[model samples]
Target: MTDKIYNVLFLCTGNSARSIIAEALLNRAGKGRFRAYSAGSQPKGEVHPYTLDLLRSLNYDISDARSKSWVEFSADGAPQMDFVFTVCDSAAAESCPIWPGHPITAHWGVPDPAAAEGSESEKRLAFADAHRMLGNRVNAFVSLPLASLDRLTTEGRVREIGRSLSEAG
Candidate 1:
């Protein structure tokens, strides 16, 4: 097998919650095989507090997590991503900058935990649910036989993973 490290970018309307959680989950679960980044069409300029709390409780490293614009990824010197996933519906619908490598893309929309309206515990539960869903999808992605599969097959698999997860809601 080739020792290729795939770069992935997760996008959302705000880079504060779903995308941020996805980035952390993939970076940890990917075991150095994948490098994950998160960004927004319109970033909130800060990672959401609840997201940070949830990640911390799960023992994930949050030092690198930050709310930034997707433009950062499109600019010169940015890493050329092999895959890109939109974690929110708004971001999936919005037009995005043309990526340099023409990376395979998918939409893995998850509910916005930060948008949950309820008591503190209830809101935290929403974050937990988002975490569970994204974790399931990311784990499925990393388990794919990416090196052996043809490009078309791999792309279809990734898209199917997204669709399956979205439908589980």
Candidate 2:
């Protein structure tokens, strides 16, 4: 296998919750095999508090997490992404900037936990649920035989991972 480390970007409307969670999960899960980044079309300008808490509770390092714009990754000198995923419905439906490398893109839409109503406990549960869903998808993705698969097959498998949750129920 080639010692190529893949770069993955997770996109969402706000970059505060879902995408942030995905980034953390993939980075840790992929180990040194992938570098994960998260950004938004319209960044909230800060990481969501509950997101930080969720990640911290799970023992993920939150030091590098921040809400950033997709424009940052599109610029020259930014790491070229091998894969790009949209984790929110709004971001998936919007027009995205043309990525330099033409990375394989997929939609892994999950409900906005930050949009969850009710008490703090309920909102926290929403974040946890989002975390769980994203975790399942990311786990499936990392389990793929990436090095052995052709580009077309790899793309299909990644997209399939996003669909597994809905298809499961």
The ten-residue window of minimal lDDT in model 1 covers 160-169
Angstrom error at residue 83, model 1: 0.3
Task: Give lDDT tens digits, candidate 2, residues 37-109.
Answer: 9999999999999999999999998999999999999999999999999999999999999998899999999
Alpha-carbon runs more than 4 Å astray in model 2: 167-169
Q: Choose the strongest candidate by lDDT.
A: 1
TM-score of model 2 vs. true structure:
0.97
Residue lDDT tens for model 1, 74-162: 99999999999999999999999999999999999999999999899999999999999999999999999899998899999999999
Each candidate's TM vs. the true structure? 0.98, 0.97
Q: State each model's CA lDDT, in order.
A: 0.96, 0.94
